[model samples]
Target: MKDLLTTTSSIIVILFCCCVLFLGDDADQHLSEPDSEMITARNHKKFLKARHPLAKTTLFRRVQSVRLKDGVLMFVTADQNGLKEHFFIIRDKNVILVKKDAGDMPPDSIKFDADGHGGIQVTIPNTFELDPLQDLLSCRN
Candidate 1:
């Protein structure tokens, strides 16, 4: 009977140690994960202080935005004075600068036409596609 009790106690202690070790490893991994607010090279450009200081140019401000299909957002930002609009898009949580104005400048050349089902259909003339895996892995400006 004493031997059986000792074996049972040993098993219980081993199981407890395994649980604590597993939980400790999991908590450490969670702590090591990158924080969303932490600034990185990809997102550092969006912050005001990191931008280049120009004599006439101030900060770029978002003047207009259009919601497109599949959780995409088209943004139009202008210089501090709201002149010289720039176009961009946020797709799959990545901000992409529009390389060319495929359509027109006043409307940013990007046509956000209406779909029959009350959703936005975006039309871009040029190739604006990006490889999600490559973007995440590589350093791109």
Candidate 2:
């Protein structure tokens, strides 16, 4: 009985050591590297330019507000000429321009004004129309 107990204990210890050696602290390192596929999948400008005829004219607009609502991300923006734009992320990689009657207007938001040479300014409600990117990095739980 003693010999059998010792043999089983030794086997278990060896298996644990092998697992520790094989798995060698790579989980954290893998997470630290920025995922290229995710970045490429999120290339919003490329997707927008492909869909819209006036995409070239609108792509230059700066980001305005990025907020999260009930796990969904909302992005609000303003163009160089003070046009307001609203965008939202429905899934991991999908972003869509929201319609005017979609929901309530975003709260007091900041946007870049071209007249001020890209200086940030407070935007008025529903003035000029534009689309923006959701601030996913800052929206972490």
| Best by the TM-score measure | 1
Residue by residue across 1-141, what tens digits does model 2's lDDT show? 999999999999999998887677676567767653443665866654553432221222345655555445456557667756564334453333332332233334433222222222223334334332343344456
Among all windows of 10 consecutive residues in model 1, the one with the lowest summed lDDT is: 51-60
* Worst 10-residue lDDT window, candidate 2: 112-121
Q: Candidate 1, residues 1-141: lDDT per residue as tens digits?
A: 999999999999999999999999999888877654677787776864442333121222333443233333444545566645343344443233333445443333454443233333344434344333354345333
Question: Cα miss at 35, model 2 (Å)?
Answer: 9.2
Could you tell me the TM-score of candidate 1? 0.28
Q: Rate the local accuracy (lDDT) of all candidates.
A: 0.48, 0.47
lDDT of 1: 0.48
